[model samples]
Target: MKLYHLPLSGHAHRAVLFLSLLGQKAELIEVDIPNGAHRTPEYLELNPFGQVPVLEDDGLVVNDSNAILVYLATKFGRKDWLPDDLKSVAKVQKWLSVAAGEIAYGPCAARLVTVFGADFRADEVIARAHRILKLIDQELEQHQFIIGDKPTIADVALYSYVVGAPEGNVDLMPYINVRHWLARIEALPGFVEFPKTAVGLRA
Candidate 1:
């Protein structure tokens, strides 16, 4: 398996971190988004969306970070990572949606403004980050993981941006449970750290 990614991208980090947690030996191919590498025709052939964190398993190409997590979890991990039962699958899918939607527009967008000089309004994104973070904090206060007792791809899906929110000026300090949840994910076996950027509030 090969993962085409950017070092500082939270989306890419989520994929890479989950791959590590699954103990998969995959090559990391850096995509230089800053240098227009992802916009190249050759790169677009792999992912028409021209995004980092595209996965190639043999000849099969998979784009989108959350999709990659589901694919790899189904292919290699135990039931705990991605179950087959209807209820459990839907539960996992819900958080994956959050990771792609709320989390993306929230913490991820906020970080993009500071770290990559993206044009998004920082205050707006930061508020969105807090809204989602508060919801996550409330959810996590009662459950150890997003779905239940065992950690799933849902947890992996939400980990990166939430942990990296501080870099976006979306402080995690007020959400103690969320902070602890981040620590719990860090303590997981085979855990990998997302490369931090000294920007925003973190700067």
Candidate 2:
């Protein structure tokens, strides 16, 4: 297995965390996103989308972070991480959507603005992101993980950007439950700390 990734990417971190937790080893090929290496012809052959994370398992190419999470969990992890029950599956999918949607636009995009100086209608998007965070805060008020008691792929999928919210200038202080939930995730075995952004992206 080969994982083509960028060091700073939260999406890439998801796969890294999952592989670590499962004690699975894949050749880590660091892609140079800053130099447009992902856009090169060589990388384009691997993934047309030119995304940071393109996992090549055997001969199969898997793109998309959430999809990778599902694949890894189903292929390598215990049933606990990727439950087979219909309701459990649906619950996990919901948070996967949250990770790709709300978390993507909020903390991820905000981090982009800080890192690349990319124009990100910050005023509008930040507010929308905050609303989503508040909803997550409320959800965490009663539950330890996103889906249930034990951490699942749902938590791994969402953990990166949501945990890195502080770097995106999104304050976690107001969301006490969310903070507690983050602590729980961090406390999990094989947990890894994300690198702090050096671009002064924090609020």
Candidate 3:
């Protein structure tokens, strides 16, 4: 398996970290987005969106970080990463949606503004980040993981941007429950960290 990624991308980190957690090895191919390498015809064939973290495994290609997590967990990871039961599946899907929707526009967008010089409104995105964090932190106060006691793709999907939220100038100090949840995820076996870029509040 080959994972085409950019080191600074949380989207890329989620896929790569999940693979590591599963003990699956894949060649890391750095896509030089800063140099417009992702815009080339060859790269576009892999992902028309020209996004980082495209995975190629045994002639099969998987695009999108969350999709890759679902694929890898279904194929190579334990049942715990993504269970088979109806309710469990639905629950996991819920957080995945949060990861894609709320988290994406919240902490992720906030980070993009500070870290990548994106033109998003800082106040708007930062407010969004805090709102989602407050909700998740409350949910986590009762549950060990996002949906339950076990770690799932839902947790993986939310981990990166949340941990790096401070870099977006979205202070996490107020989210105590969220902080504990982050530590728990880090303590999981075979856990790997996304590279932290010093920016925003940390800067």
Candidate 4:
């Protein structure tokens, strides 16, 4: 298996973090997004969207980060990470959608603005980040993980951009429950960190 990724991408980091947590090994191929490597013809063949965190395994290509997490967990039979029951599965799918939709335009987009100079309205995205974060915090206030007590791919899906939210200047201090939840994931075995932004490093 090969994971084509960019170190600074939250989307990529989620996939990388999950692989480690699952004790799965894959070749790490760093896609040079800054130098147009992801936009090249060859990379386009792998992911038509030209996104980072594309996974290639045994002639199969998985294009999105959430998709990669689902694939890995299912393939490895890590039910602890990907539950098989009915209600849990539906809830997990719901959170995954949040990760892709709300989380993407929320924290992810905000971070992109500050970290990579992407042209998104900072105020808008930051507000969106806080809104979804408040809902997540409310849910996590009672449950150990997004879906329930055990950590699932839903947790992995939400972890990256949420952990990196502050880099976009969206303060996380107000969300104590969310902070605690993050600490729990970090304490898990084989956990990995999403790299701080260049600005954060210099600070």
Using all chains and alpha carbons, the TM-scores for the candidates as numbered come to 0.97, 0.95, 0.98, 0.97
- Model 3 TM-score relative to the real fold: 0.98
Better TM-score candidate (1, 2): 1
| Best-to-worst TM-score order | 3, 1, 4, 2
Q: For candidate 2, lDDT tens digit of each residue in 45-162?
A: 9989999788899899899888888898888757889999999989998999989988898878877777668799866666766888899988887778887888999989888888
Top-down lDDT ranking? 3, 4, 1, 2
- Candidate 4, residues 41-132, lDDT tens digits: the string is 99999999999899999999999999999999999989888888898889999999999999999999989888999999999999999999
List RMSD in Å for every model shown.
0.9, 1.4, 0.8, 1.4
**lDDT string, candidate 1, 1-203, tens digits:** 89999889898998999988988889999998888998999999999999989999989999999999989987885687998899989999999999999999999999988888899988899999999999999999888888887899999999999998889999899999999888999999999999987887788
Model 1 steric clash pairs: none
Number of the predicted model whose lDDT against the real structure is largest = 3
Q: Which ten residues in a row have the lowest lDDT in candidate 3?
A: 72-81
lDDT of 3: 0.93
Give each model's whole-structure lDDT.
0.92, 0.84, 0.93, 0.92
* Residue-wise C-alpha lDDT for candidate 3, range 119-169, written one tens digit per residue: 999999999999999999999989888989989999999999999999999
Task: State the displacement of the C-alpha of residue 144, model 2, in Å, after optimal TM-score superposition.
Answer: 0.7
